[model samples]
Target chain A: EAGVTQFPSHSVIEKGQTVTLRCDPISGHDNLYWYRRVMGKEIKFLLHFVKESKQDESGMPNNRFLAERTGGTYSTLKVQPAELEDSGVYFCASSQVGLFRPTYGYTFGSGTRLTVV
Target chain B: QQQVKQSPQSLIVQKGGISIINCAYENTAFDYFPWYQQFPGKGPALLIAIRPDVSEKKEGRFTISFNKSAKQFSLHIMDSQPGDSATYFCAASIGGKLIFGQGTELSVKP
Candidate 1:
């Protein structure tokens, strides 16, 4: 089976511009998550979608960032008026129905490297 | 608050030696603990994982020692090799939401 896939592996945008990153999860996976790692920092969770419904969005940094998973298949994270701090690698991961079951580990996409200049 | 805390921002180990990385978590509700390995410019891949119910789990040369009471866990790499060098991240999850620790960059010298 194909693993999670991300679009536009690298993106460069000017400050105050907008950017959207996309992720396609593995087939039959019900849970999708968004995470990003800033320069010299650990990866941080942004939000999670269980199908078409968002399970938790507490990790979203600010109002400028938005994530959606319509139809619970693919997910998109949009950054409006992107700031320099938004420049980083955005990763998307997916897991099967079970919650952290050993049989299925979260499969992550290669990630999108975003640069805000 | 950072739920998970990992130590040794970086480590250099000689080949065939033992490499140990430690992590502590504040949330007792976290039942699933997983370790992820990431190479430069690549997304993290699942290395090994252990549940709070088990004290230790071993897979080949990689072992995870989980301490539920102390809320601490660790990853041990035996007979370390250059191929094992990467950034390792420890994460905990409850209800499917994961909280990750600061990653540990490991370098194995040949």
Candidate 2:
């Protein structure tokens, strides 16, 4: 099925540098999500993983932002000291459970365009 | 608190015209209402969805109109083209965790 897949896509980094964004879901997907968009705004939510725990991170926006889903399969978002509003565009999504299933569509990932300068 | 509220941030239909976009939500327990379609760099995609017992839900030319007591929801794009422009999001969820609406930049002009 291979859909959600993110990586370097684009990243510039500078301010206090330290960036890491990667996602590779869609293989038995257990639900993994993280979103951000801060150019003009509107695309929030920043945490959620169902296999490596962390069901929700309450939309993490602080603590230098860090996210990881190690054993549950692909996911990582780390922005240590990066600032400059931490640039934006970092989306990773996945879905596959069954509860509200409607073919469970939620497979975004063509994002990762952080340019914190 | 901005649960959702989308409107004419941008729109300019023409090619066979008929493109409407609107959204309003404040969490009525939200019953799934999705509508996403991004293009520029790509990310969103799921162009049509509706729930709330269904007030409407088409697919071909896209349509999703649900109004559970005015919680509002809409997205119509009948014959528009120009590849149907892009950027349009209106979301709401109850169990899958979604809550967006501040996008709409459809510019379908032939």
Candidate 3:
């Protein structure tokens, strides 16, 4: 099966500009999650989607960031008025809901590298 | 606490030796622990995992030793190879969300 796919493998934008990252999860996977890792920092969760419904979004940094998973398929994360601190690698992961899956079935995308200057 | 602490920030090991990375968490509610390996330009991928019920789990050249009482876990790479050089992250899972520790970069010299 094709793994999770993320578009715009790399992006660079000026401060206060807007940038959007896309992720297409594997078919039949019901759990989708977004994470970000700043330079020299650990990867941190941003949000989770369970079939288009947000299960948790506490990790979202602020109002400038928005995430949406439409139709329970692909997901988009938009950073409006991007700041220098927002520059990081955005990763999307998916997992199938099952009791017998291997290691909870987490598959991560290659991730989109965002740079704000 | 929600954080997972990891150290040392980086390591260098000779091939055919062992590489160890340690992590500790303060949340006892965490029931699952997993280690992820990431190469440059790639997202993290699961290397191995262990539950609180097990003190140790090994796969191939990878092993996860869990210390539930101390709320700590470590990843051991046996017969470390140059290919095993990468950034490794330790994460604790609770309610399907992972709390990750600072990553450790491992370099194995051939």
Candidate 4:
């Protein structure tokens, strides 16, 4: 099976511009998650989607960011008026949903490096 | 906010030696702990994981030691090789959401 896929390995935008990052999770994975890592910080959770519905969006930093997962397949994170602080690597991961299953099944994408200047 | 704390921001070890990275967390509700390895230009890959019920779990050359009371865990790489050089992250999970620690960059010289 193919691993999770993310496009535009790198992106650079002005501080007030908008940028959208896309992620294609592994086939049949219903749990999609978004995480971001600042230059010297740990990776932080951004949100989670269970199929087309968002299971959790508490990790979202602010109102400038929006995430959507349509039809439970692909996910997109849009940062409107990207800020200089938003420069970091945005990661996407997918996993199967089950109460008894371990999280080792979680597969991550290479990530999109977003740089706001 | 919950957080996982990892020590030794970076480390360098000679070949055929043992490399260890430690992490501690304040959240006792976290039931799952996993270690991830990430190379440059690549995403993090699951190296190994352990639950609270077990004190330790080992796979191949990777070992995860968990201390329930201490709320701490560590990853030990036995017979460390150059290929083991990468960024290691320790993460704790609750309800399937992960809280990660500051990564440790390990450099194994051959």
Q: What is the descending lDDT order?
A: 4, 3, 1, 2
Query: Candidate 3: misplaced stretches above 4 Å?
Result: A98-102
lDDT of 1 by residue, A1-117 (tens): 999999889999999999999999999999999999997787889998889898899889999999989888999999999999999999999999765685775889999999999
Error of 2 at A55 (Å): 15
A1-117, model 3: which lDDT tens digit per residue?
Answer: 999999899999999999999999999999999999999999999999998999999999999999999999999999998999999999999998753234557889999999999
Candidate 3: deviation at residue A56, Å? 0.2
Give model 2's docking category. acceptable
Give i-RMS (Å) per prediction: 1.3, 8.7, 2.1, 1.4
TM-score list, all predictions: 0.96, 0.34, 0.97, 0.98
Q: Candidate 1 residues B26-95, lDDT tens each?
A: 8788878999999987899989999899999999999999988899999999999999999999999877
lDDT for model 1 comes to 0.91
lDDT of 4 at B25: 94
Task: List DockQ for all candidates.
Answer: 0.74, 0.23, 0.67, 0.77
The candidate scoring highest on lDDT is: 4
Fraction of native contacts in model 4? Answer: 0.79
| Residue A78 CA displacement from its true place in model 3, Å | 0.5
List runs of model 4 lying over 4 Å from the truth. none
Backbone clash tally for model 3?
0
Question: Model 4 has how many clashing residue pairs?
Answer: 0
